[model samples]
Target chain A: MGFLEALNYPIYVAIFICVYSFLAIGLNVQWGYAGLFNAGVAGFFAVGAYTSAILTSPDVPGRLGGFGLPFIAGVAGAMLLSALVALPIGKICLRFRGDYLAIVTIGVAEAIRIFARSEEWITGSSRGIQNLPRPFGDLPYVYSQLAYLALVAAILLVVYLLVERQSASPWGRMMRAIRDNEVAAMAMGKDVPFRRLQAFVFGAALMGLGGALYAHLGRSITPEAIDPMIASFLIWIMVILGGSGNNRGVLAGVTIVWIIWTASEFVTDQLPMEYALQAKYGRIFLIGLMLQLVLRFRPNGIFPEFRPTQKDSRKPDKSDKA
Target chain B: MLDFINFYVVPGIVTGSIYAFAAIGITLVFSIMRHAHLAHGDMATMGAYIALAASTMLGLPVYFALLLAIPLTAALAVGTDKLFYEHLRKKPKILTTMSTLGTALMLRSIVQVVWGVGTTSYAKGITRPNDWFGLKIKTNELITLLALAVVVLGLAAFLNRTRWGKAMRAMSDNRDLALLCGIDNARVITLTWLIVGGLCAISGFFLGINTEIKSMMGWNIILPAFAGAILGGIGRIEGALVGGLMIGLVEELSVLFIPTEYKAVSAFAILLLVLLVRPRGLFNGKII
Candidate 1:
């Protein structure tokens, strides 16, 4: 393969890494910053992908949309619709403990998958939405790929900066406080449930945005693309492995995991046809085993949450003497 | 009326019995471990497949295959606890819950790799329902109900009559108090997993017998089973049974009013309604 040929694969992989970064960062906001377990990452992703596809694609006679709106509108609409969907779910499940939230989210994701599969008018009933516009469609294949990669990376950068800033602010501290000790936070007059809902909805919006990016890149939105194994659990492993609270750590995690996942597929394809299919499952088993190893050895992740020492108001500071 | 009973109600009861088996195991894990065992469904799937192997490979009868599956599945459950969940016992319960999700994925992938993902069943030919006066009931359906009854009664007797069972209950009620009372928490946990695992195997085995066993079958039923567990009041075994039956019936009956594809929605709807209206569940089980 020529230099450009090799570059094409890297660009493609990099674009996916950028998209997955959004999911990991979104999950980090929920699970890392706020200690909310939102397991339905795929659900939000599907909503976003479908919304964008419906908005941007040319009019289809039988289906719901084909409004032919601009790409920006579709992306924004994706975020809005995803947040709207998360609102009630977070409101209901957030009142309970994290485990309840996790189960509810899983169900919600499955329900969304069913809807995407069966609701022919809305989601095209497994055929999915095709002929969606790509931003640099007129460009050569390699250039378009590069452009998309740059675009997603830029968006990821912006999201990372904003999230980092938020995590550093007092609101972030309050969220951490609520997460670490709900009763204590409540005692200190933090609106625990409402704050949780805020984090959950916010994180869901990012996931939706990620989905929109993915849909537009692929120039189609399909139910299969939103499988829990890839869209949800993969993001989860990324977040948990990267160090949930650290934005940079999660990005690093995204890069590491996506490489392993994609690289393994290539390696498995080299195997005999019969064994290849089994190798695919073996890869998944490896991912699952990786999570167990991470949980057992480095529960806090690669870069643990940065904890600034709090000065006690009741006593004189000892740091000055040191 | 007979058609309704045969088509919806009878099938509902059979499936409900299956759900009850899974839900009971979930409730046991939830109450005893203070975390959702997210792998519970996949564990059931594993059990069902094991029974299939026993019957197909070992040439055992289906019931005898189930008997073999029960102890093996119980051991698998306890083994997972020892290998994956033991150290996390002192950590946050949510960590263990997250780990179980990974375990779920692992278990499902194992099933897919071993069984090759295509659907399979114990027996090849379909058994026609036996006519009883006006009512039609399959022999397997009858067997399912009988099995459910036996399991429930046996579990009730064990929980009420045995010291170890009482210790398990005490731990569920209050871990610190149970510990202070010199109850061996480890033994109680192991005993709980043994019961839960056996229940999982039975549920999976029956679900496969009634329907077909696919890799995704247990994952699909997991939502309804959870709905049943939550509706019945999380920690109550009887609540799980009732909830499971209700969910199964409602799901079956929903096909009459909505597209058959949307039957799963009934469980999701019920789960939301229960969570909104009765977070403590119908039997006043612990929310924690």
Candidate 2:
């Protein structure tokens, strides 16, 4: 494979990095900025993916379909719907701290996956809805995937800038205040739980946006794409490995990890193991190893987020010592 | 009609006992460690698999296999703690929780890679179902009930009697206070994992024997197992024992009204509703 052939895979990986980076940022918002240990990111991601697919796909008749809504509308729809679902989940989970919240969110995401698997009418169950219309589906030699990649990148860039701006805003500062010292924040007359809820909802909406972008890029919608493990574990690793509180750190983390993931997947055949088994697990092992190493050495992640001189790190205050 | 009650309800109790057995390990570790061992189900599976590898494969007797698996799983739990979870200490609870998430994924992959990602059954095939006092129950199911009763009783005695068990209780009550009281908190924590590992193995054996054995078998039941743990009051062993039984009975008896597939959701439904309505859990935990 020459440059062009090799380039396609990496280019595709770039797109994945772009999408997952936003997903990580979304998680970084919920977890890093707010003390919400949301393990159900995959649920919001699926919500975004399914919403986009359902609205754009030609298959379903009765519900929201056949409009061929513009990509922007579909993306916005996913964001709105995700925020809607997040409102209650955020409120509910905001009350619990640490392990209790983790268990609940993981269960919630799994339940969502189960619901997705069972609800055939809306999501088409296991068969999945494919050939979801792209904005320029019929244009010849369009490098359609490349175009989708550009579109996703643009959305991600906007989200990144917006999150950066908001993280510096009064509300964002209040979010960090609650995360750092809830008692003090409450003493300062900040509605601590309410602030956390806002962060949760905002973070979840970002996840929804990433999910919608990913679904369109993949050119198909399937329940399997949104495994809770994939949504939660990978996003957690990204935020942790990339400086969780740092926006730039998050970008570096997402890019580096996704590149390794996609690249390892490509090169697994050369690995010295049972070809059949190793190929399947190659991706998981790589990510798992990196997660362990990062947690061990740089629990704060690779690039420590630049703490604004006035603000403290919004990361979870030291809790349990291993 | 009377026969149906004996067959279903009685059998339901037996099945519930097994779930309760499994839930005990999860609850113990969850309460103590403050983060769940996502691989609790897999620990059970690993125990069952260890029993198979040691006893049946090596030509050891059934009891001998279990004897080996008990200690081995206990050791494995310690190793897992040191290797994976140890790195996550003092990090945010959420971050440590994610580490367990990573650990679960890693352990699952290791199980799949080692065992070929397929279901493996016990070599000693279960022989027969029996009619005891007009109630039809499989021998394995009977064993499940007996094991649950014995384990629960044994755990109660251990917690109430032994110095180490009491130390564990102290730690569970409050880690900082436990340390302040001159309790070797680390040693107590390790012992807790050991006991949990052994008991969890038995639960694993029963689970695989009752159904098909697969690597994902434990992972699949994780949600329900968590359900049992939470329902029982997160840290209380007695609570876990009761909660597991309740979840299991609800799941089994629920099949009559629901499609069997939906039976799995019963525990989660209980989990969600419980968390929503009663966050402190059925036992009231620290509050009461």
Measured with C-alpha atoms, the lDDT of residue B202 in candidate 1 is 95
What is the lDDT, from 0 to 100, of the residue B165 in candidate 2?
Answer: 83
Question: Pairs clashing in candidate 2?
Answer: A320-B90, A321-B89, A321-B90, A322-B89, A322-B90
Residue A280 miss distance in model 1 (angstroms): 1.0
Using all chains and alpha carbons, the TM-scores for the candidates as numbered come to: 0.97, 0.92
Model 2 misplaced stretches (Cα beyond 4 Å): A1-6, A60-67, A270-274, A308-322, B2-11, B124-127
Among these predictions, the greatest TM-score belongs to 1
What are the TM values for chain B, all candidates? 0.99, 0.92
lDDT of 1: 0.92
Measured against the native two-chain assembly using Cα atoms, what DockQ does each of the candidate structures obtain, in the order listed? 0.76, 0.50
TM-score of 2: 0.92
How high is the lDDT of residue B123 in model 1? 95
- Candidate 2, residues A1-322, lDDT tens digits: the string is 3555556766677788888887899988987888677878898999988888877777565344565777778788999899998897666656777566676677778777877777777777786767776754564323655666777788788888998998889877888888888889989999877888888888888899888888887678888899765677777777888888888888998887767666666587566666845567656765677778888889778888666663443333433332
Error of 1 at B77 (Å): 0.1
